[model samples]
Target: MSKIGVEQSLTNVQDALRAKGYDIVELKQESDAQNVDCCVVTGLDSNVLGEQTTSIKGSVIEANGLTADEVCQQVEQKLRH
Candidate 1:
């Protein structure tokens, strides 16, 4: 199972991903996102400072205006590549 980093605010998404058999890691801090294959965020704090930092090479899935299922689908697609 691929590891996934999920924002603490997204409880629904965490449950949905867990049901799908993915290894879910709660992203509490900057280092929490380390080693995960994909990350799910609420898109609230991203790009706020207009500065980008490269901590992980995996894809970042923004959970804004999308359902858990849709986010899961994107996670799958991103992992495939």
Candidate 2:
């Protein structure tokens, strides 16, 4: 079970990912991403991620403008690689 950190502003994608068995964590601050394998975000909001936006440890997924299914697909692919 991989953990995914989602920017707080992008909560819409959380439910969809959670159903897929990914452990979702709300990324309110940099510390929240410590244990996550990937960070899903909407590129529209840089401030929402603080400094973590630029230097995320794992893959940084830009899900903005994508549907929930699209977002899930992107996340799924990232986890695979």
Candidate 3:
């Protein structure tokens, strides 16, 4: 499971990800000056969780108001190794 906090309108994005079999642990709404918004999604591998490892962690920051595709692409590029 992962913690995913997002703004109001990005529910579609969240839903889409969940449909793809992601473990969503949490979600929250946040405000921003520009329509562009961001959400932080954190994921941990099973081994890390089982071992209670604090060193292994991952995060993705998804933004909106800019093109959703672009935001997602950027997030993917940044987060994926």
The candidate scoring highest on lDDT is 1
- Measured by TM-score, how close is model 3 to the native structure? 0.38
- The parts of candidate 2 lying over 4 Å away from their true place are 52-54
When summed lDDT is taken over every stretch of 10 residues in candidate 1, the lowest stretch is 47-56
Q: Per-residue lDDT of 1-81 in model 2, one digit per residue for the tens?
A: 989998877777998999898899998877787878898888887666577444656788888789888988988888888
Query: Weakest 10 consecutive residues, lDDT, candidate 2?
Result: 47-56
lDDT string, candidate 3, 1-81, tens digits:
333343345556656546544444334322221122224332332222223332313443535344545545654554455
Give the alpha carbon lDDT tens digit for every residue of 41-80 in model 1. Answer: 9999885223466477798899999999999999999999
- Record all residue pairs in model 3 with backbone atoms less than 3 Å apart, i.e. clashing: none
**Candidate 3 local distance difference test against the native:** 0.40
Clashes of 3: 0
Better of 1 and 2 by TM-score: 1
Q: lDDT score of model 2? A: 0.83
Candidate closer to the true structure by lDDT (higher is better), 2 or 3: 2
| Global lDDT of each candidate | 0.88, 0.83, 0.40
Residue pairs with colliding backbones in model 2 are none
Model 2, residue 6: displacement in angstroms?
0.6
